[model samples]
Target: MGAWFTHLILQLAAILGSSLVTPTPLVRTDSGAQLERDWGQQVRLKHLYMEGNSRHLQINPDGHIDSSHAQNFYTLLEIKAVERGQVVIRGVNTDQYLCMDTEGNIFGSTTYREDDCNFNEEQLETFYNVYHSPRHKKVLSLSLEKRPYIPNRELPPLSMFLPRENELPMATYSRRSSERETNDTDPFGMRSGQQASPKLSRSSRG
Candidate 1:
């Protein structure tokens, strides 16, 4: 009986440990095949600027978001994972989150409002990130057109879907700095790095 009890306890422990393993948030090629070790690390994205224009995407003090040459704090972003593939890009300086309206207009908001700001961060062949909104939804992309940034729903000509004036560009971004201890943690969970991962499960009682 004693030996049997010990074996049962060992099995339970192994299952618990495996469940506790936290996966990384960053994807190597968006294939979801592999994950980087930095799950909660902070990262910066510089817009892929053209030759003569030297600017990164920034949110102005008035809450106007546009590409700018300045590489200040306003241009820095903290990526917050909302779910498996969805993330919200919040401006480090303004503390406001970036979201899109139903009309596909891009803007910054102080809080998340469901479909308004959530995006599927797609890594394209050009290595730039494309923030794709939901079906019948749109985001301001490299192509400044009215078309939604989803597959199969784009215009037939395909040229209209190409990068346009003031649209986000392919090879349009370069990532910088995976700072330590910058991960956003749950109020209930131990501080990042102290815990193997953030809260995988939640309770109402708290």
Candidate 2:
């Protein structure tokens, strides 16, 4: 009788142990209309020119998404509604989720293993959408241009969103620099005293 009782107790303990380790399934309500009103279908994130560039955000082959990539098949994503105002950004092509970690770097996740990947989709008063990760409460942005020739090890783990400029400084700078170089140097590789003008005179026009 004592051996049988011991065996029963062991079985109960094993059952309890299994229950402790088991993860509880997420229970969702049938709020179809509510979900539709809040979360739209799969969409591509286009960079707001007022906030940054006009490029579209896309996940690269290495499993990182940024604004440097143009709108394409791999860049398309779905925004799924979660608890509260939070949501998950999933890549339609790769079937991975856009999640952040404790260090505040964003990456693609195959599973919902960390809470950092879930973000709060806060609509700013400026009518722009900002994604805030719960881990560090920092907003994610894709404003940096990709340098493909650069080595991966030398690159930063995450790219930061640059603030919007009234005019494109890079483009303007390149143009002005080219003009100065042309004006300073002649085609024969000699220093010119006067600026070279491409416009022809009226007599020369004939």
The residue-by-residue lDDT of candidate 1 on 1-206, one tens digit each, is: 99999999999999999999997787465434113312233333333232223456666566676766645566666565555556566665565666666666566765445555567655445433456676335644533565566654443121121111233332323222223234344321122322343221112001
Assess each prediction's global lDDT (C-alpha) against the native.
0.49, 0.48
Cα distance off (Å), candidate 1, residue 63:
1.4
- Model 2 misplacement above 4 A: 1-37, 40-50, 143-206
| lDDT of model 1, residue 120 | 65
Which lDDT tens digits does candidate 2 get at residues 85-160? Answer: 6666665546556766544556665444335457766554444455667655555644332222121222222333
Error of 1 at 119 (Å): 0.7
TM-scores, one per candidate: 0.52, 0.46
lDDT comparing candidate 1 with the true structure? 0.49
Best by lDDT: 1
- TM-score of structure candidate 1: 0.52
